[model samples]
Target: MKLRPLLITASRWKQIQQPLYPWVVTVDRIMRHERLGNMPGPLVHLFSDYGGAHKESLYETTAVLYMDVDNSMPWQVERLRVRQHFLPDGRRMSFKGLNDVKKQQALIPFLQASDSIPGVLLVAAVHKSIKNLCWSKDVRPDWPSDRAMRHKWSPRTFERALHVSHLAGLMVGGLSNPGQEVFWFSDEDELFANPTASNDVGNLFTMFTSVYANHPFKQIGLGTTAIDEGDRYEEDHVALADLAAGSAADMLTELAKYAGHIPTKVAIEFPGEFSRKTEIITSWLGYSGGNLKKVMVVLEPQGKTGFSVMRLNW
Candidate 1:
C-alpha cells in the first residue's frame, strides 16, 4: 500500500527543532535506504519483512501501544494473549505440517467488537544517523573496524538503538500507568509494570551515550547523567513505542521528498511531563472508549525554505 501523505503547514514546519533534526535526517536516511539498502542489516531485515501483502500487518504490529488492563479481568488477559500471539488481522495458525500451517483469519474485528480493553498508546520515531555518528565519534573506540561497516551492527549499535526506542516507549508508558500493578508495554506484551522500571530507565544511558542521550536531559536542564530506565521493547507497550518510532520515521521519509533537505531526526512523541495540558486522548475504535490517543508533533529545519508532509495511521 502507498504511504499516507503528510501536508506539513508552515506552523508544523516551525515545530521542528535542532534536537529533533537528527531524527528527521535519520528518517530520510532510512527512507533512502528503502531504495538504496544501506541501513544496518537487522533494521533492513525488518523493513524488508513488511512488503506487499504484509505491509499493513507490519503497520499494525509495529505500531506499539501502551495498554492498561484490569489485573483481575480474566477475559481481558485472554483477549490480550490472543492479540499478542496472533497477527493483528487475526490470522491464527495451527501448524499441521513443518512448512504449512492452517490459517485462521478474521479474529481481531470480532474480538474488538465484542470486548475491547482500554489503554493508552504512546510512540515516537527518530533518525539514527545522528546517534550513529555520535556513537562512532564519542563512544565507538574503533570506528573503522566496527561490525556496522559490514552491515552487521555491533551489539552496542543494536543496544543503542534498542535503548533509545525503549526509552521513548517508557516515557510514553509513564503517562498511562496511573494506578495499576501491571501495565502492558508494547504490542508484544512481553514487558510490564514492575520494579525493573528504574533499571529500564538506567539502561538507556548506559547503552548509548550519544548526544541524544544527554540531549533529553539537556533539554530539561538536567545536567546529571544518571537515569532510571524502563522495560525492554519486547513488551507490548514498547512495541507501540516502536510502532510510533517507526511510524514517525516512515512519515519523515516521505516528508523528505518535498523538503529538499535531509533532516537529522524527526521525533513524534506525546507531550512529556511538562506539556500535560496538550496531551489529548480520543476513542480510536468508535464507541469502545479505548484509552487510545494520537500525538502528532511536526518540525522542520531551523532555517529551511520548503515544506512537505507524510501521514502514519494506526
Candidate 2:
C-alpha cells in the first residue's frame, strides 16, 4: 500500500500547537467493561462496507466495532458471507453461501453467535460526516506541508472516517487495559521499513504513545502497541471483528428508521424483514438512554456535535 507521508517542518509543528478548538465535550465513561484481561489476538479491527452512511451527505456516519477474542479456533460461521441485494423497494442484506432463506434473512443470529464466543468484547465507535472533521484535511494552513499525510489510504472522506474509527478502537483498548499491547493491521516488511512513521501501523503506534503520555479516561499505565496484516477470511479474530462492526452498522441503520432517516435507503429496513433478529440484537446490546447504544461518546468542535455517551456507574 503506497501512502503519502506526513512531513512536518519545525515551523509547521509550532503553528499546530496553537489551540484551534479551546474546549471539547467528551464522553466520560466510554469503555464500560472493567474486568479487562491481557490476551493475544487482533487488538481491534473495523468493518464499514455495511452501507450505514448517514443522511444529507454533509457527514457520513460510520460505526466501527472491535473485539478481542481468546486464542482459539475461528468461529464456525466465519465462512458465512453477508452479501448486499437490491430491489424496487430498497436494499436487502443477507448471509450467502447457504440457501436457508433464499431471500433476505436477519443477520442478528450470526451477530449474536459471534458475540457469544467466550472472552469477547464488543466496543463501538461511530464517525459522523467524517469529511467535515478538522483532522481530515490533508494539508492545513497551520501545517502547510504538501507532502503531509492525510489519514490512511484515501483522502477527504475516507481519511477522516479512518481516523475516527482508529481513535474509537484505541480509546477502547487504551482505556480498557491501560498498558496492554495492541496489534494493529500491518505487515512485517512495512513495519521493518518505517517502524515508527509508517502510514497506518506506525502512525497508530505513535498515536497510542501520545495518548499514553497525556492519558485520560479511567485506566492508567504506559500502553504498548504493535501491528498486523488483517485477512478477513483466513483470520478468525479479524473475521469476528468484521462481523461485530457490520452488526453495529446494521443496527445503526435500523435506528435511523425510527429517526425518520434510513441509511443507504435500503429497501429492507431494519426489523422490516428481520424483526425477530432486531429484537435479539437490541436485547444483547441494550439501549443507552433512548438511543441504540451504538456510540458511547463523541468529541467535536464547539458548534459541531457528535454522539452522546451514557453516564458511568463508576
RMSD from true fold, candidate 2: 12.9
Task: Give lDDT tens digits, candidate 2, residues 1-314.
Answer: 01112232221000111222221112212232323333334333332222233452222333333334333234433323322221222223331212335323535444444543324233333445333444534424554353354333434444443344344444443433434344333212222234233454344434433443333333212111122222223233333333334444555444544544322212332335334443444455442331112332222122355333221110
lDDT for each of the candidates? 0.29, 0.34
TM-score of candidate 2 versus the correct structure, residues matched by position: 0.46
Question: How many collisions per candidate?
Answer: 45, 8
- Give TM-scores for every candidate, taking all chains together and pairing residue i with residue i: 0.35, 0.46
Tens digits of lDDT, candidate 1, 69-137: 332144345545555555444332211111222122323332342233233332333222223323434
What's the C-alpha lDDT at position 36 in model 2?
A: 30
Q: Which ten residues in a row have the lowest lDDT in candidate 1?
A: 43-52
Q: Tell me the deviation in Å of residue 126 in model 2.
A: 4.1
| Top TM-score prediction, candidate number | 2
Error of 2 at 95 (Å): 6.6
